[model samples]
Target chain A: MTERVRVKTMMPPGHVRTPAYLRGKVGVIERELGGFSNPEQLAYGLPAEERPLYRVRFTMEEVWGAAAETPTDTVDAEIFGHWLERL
Target chain B: MPHDHPSHSHEGMSPSGHPYRADNDTALTYWQRMEIAVRELLVEKGAVTPEEVARQIDTMDARSPANGAAVVARAWVDPDFKARLLQDASAASREMGFDIGPLRLIAVENTESVHNLIVCTLCSCYPRNLLGLPPDWYKTRAYRSRAVIEPRAVLREFGVELPDHVQVRVHDSTADMRYVVLPARPAGTEGLDEAELAALVTRDSMIGTGLPRTP
Candidate 1:
């Protein structure tokens, strides 16, 4: 079994339940906080609290097609700030 | 906007473009007002701490892909792998070393003639491991409602216009199985390596809007 998942909080422009589509794709940590379990941070589509979270970046090509038209190279996505991992 | 004429989607029938069930109009969507009440109740009862909820999200955002370069590369070259992908996407994904986290997954393959679209019927359930967070449109009421009844119209809103002949299939995502749309492999990609072809795949294409390259 994988270790218990640990999510980190990213900077404001807050957090939400990282969509299942984005989990475990090597995004950068947009924010990392000491862990907590507050449910209120889910508002504004992110963490429901001031708990630990991580904001990450992803490219449209990474998430969709490589030929995607974009003004930028990558798209930023946030995760739980963490997850159960295999050692 | 007020109008003298009746609206098309409001006749209280699925065929009339009304997306909600005949009875759903009276219900409070669980994600909005009801969920707020639930959170308040839980916090007041002290059954679950609010901090735990945020922590759960925190853990989620941490794992999103910073890049999709690699997965795209793999799908381009391996015909056997592509066939495997068409059969069972999540299983195929595992072969590529992508962590699916705790979400149930379903991959919809885009063939030459057939098309698939993804939507979240309840809140949003996206295939985060491969695609990342869903776009705001995916979660909005406009998409959730219209996608089911008028998929072609919804896709058009997203800038995908299909021909009269191409059939559209819509999948409404929920908490259970997160879905992804796999675009058909581009032609003229034969001589190119996997990585080269993967570069042509875009996020919008996977959502079933944009077409694959060299179509």
Candidate 2:
């Protein structure tokens, strides 16, 4: 394939766990940071290691713009175990 | 922990001779306990090495306003692209490398010709794949509460002054999906290319606060 395509995900409104803080903001897929089986089902009383998933790197500025002023500046955020599409 | 040996439980008295009370959930900070517990537990369990975590954080140094810049640039250069964005934002965004992720996105166009405002009443639902994250104000209770009741006032805070009847349609984004407002292309930018136009469309403009920059 594309040498292991980089994947990432964001949740829908009501059920999404990722805060709206990161929703709809633009960022690049920094890299594949391994993967999680599914932490949600575990968190919400589901069996552990049951949530299927993907995750990757996204910078804070990519999501917040310049207004997110800070010395550290970049926020290397991790998305989740699922919800991704080709870039 | 103390074990009680009384035949019947005592009421309004301390279990250990020291008053026992509980904190209210509403009075508590949202997810504060969970955040601390998770972070501490992760460090304790050694699931993610501390040094690695620091290294991961170090990578955030590369972030930039390029996405906003790109959006503004695209709006400047192409009329057809802008029209498509106004018509169907998700599809148009894909053309610009923004894959709209798990939640679908609907972009409402606001213009000199027509104005539109967006809000999510049921919490701060949003399209994540296109824009990186929602601003702090977008998630504030003040915004969620007022956008529906007094959109004009909220917009005014962002320096957007609207006419008496610009047909403001306030949409409520649910927890299921989200929205983004595509403010109208400004004047004096009639002949620019797609890249030029995108530069004009700032994050504020997309949220219906500020208008796109002209010239």
**Maximum-TM-score candidate:** 2
- In angstroms, give how far residue A20 of model 2 lies from its true place: 20
Q: Indicate the residue-level lDDT of B34 in model 1.
A: 80
Q: Candidate 2's C-alpha lDDT?
A: 0.56
Model 1 lDDT per residue over A50-86, tens place: 4454434443344445443331233333334334222
Candidate lDDT scores, in order, read: 0.57, 0.56
Q: In CAPRI terms, where does candidate 2 land?
A: incorrect
Task: Please report the TM-score between candidate 2 and the true structure.
Answer: 0.52
Query: What's the fnat for candidate 1, on a 0 to 1 scale?
Result: 0.00
lDDT of 2 by residue, B1-215 (tens): 25564665666667565446775556546698787778779999988777877765454323233454465456546678767765666677677775444544556666555555556665666554555666788889898766655566777888877776464555555323356666666777778776766767776666666677777
Candidate 2 on A4-85: residue-level lDDT in tens?
2223344443344444554554444533434454544544666656333332333334544664322112222344535444
- Candidate with the greatest lDDT versus the true structure: 1
Query: Which 10 consecutive positions of candidate 2 chain B have the poorest summed lDDT?
Result: B57-66
TM-score of chain B of 1: 0.66
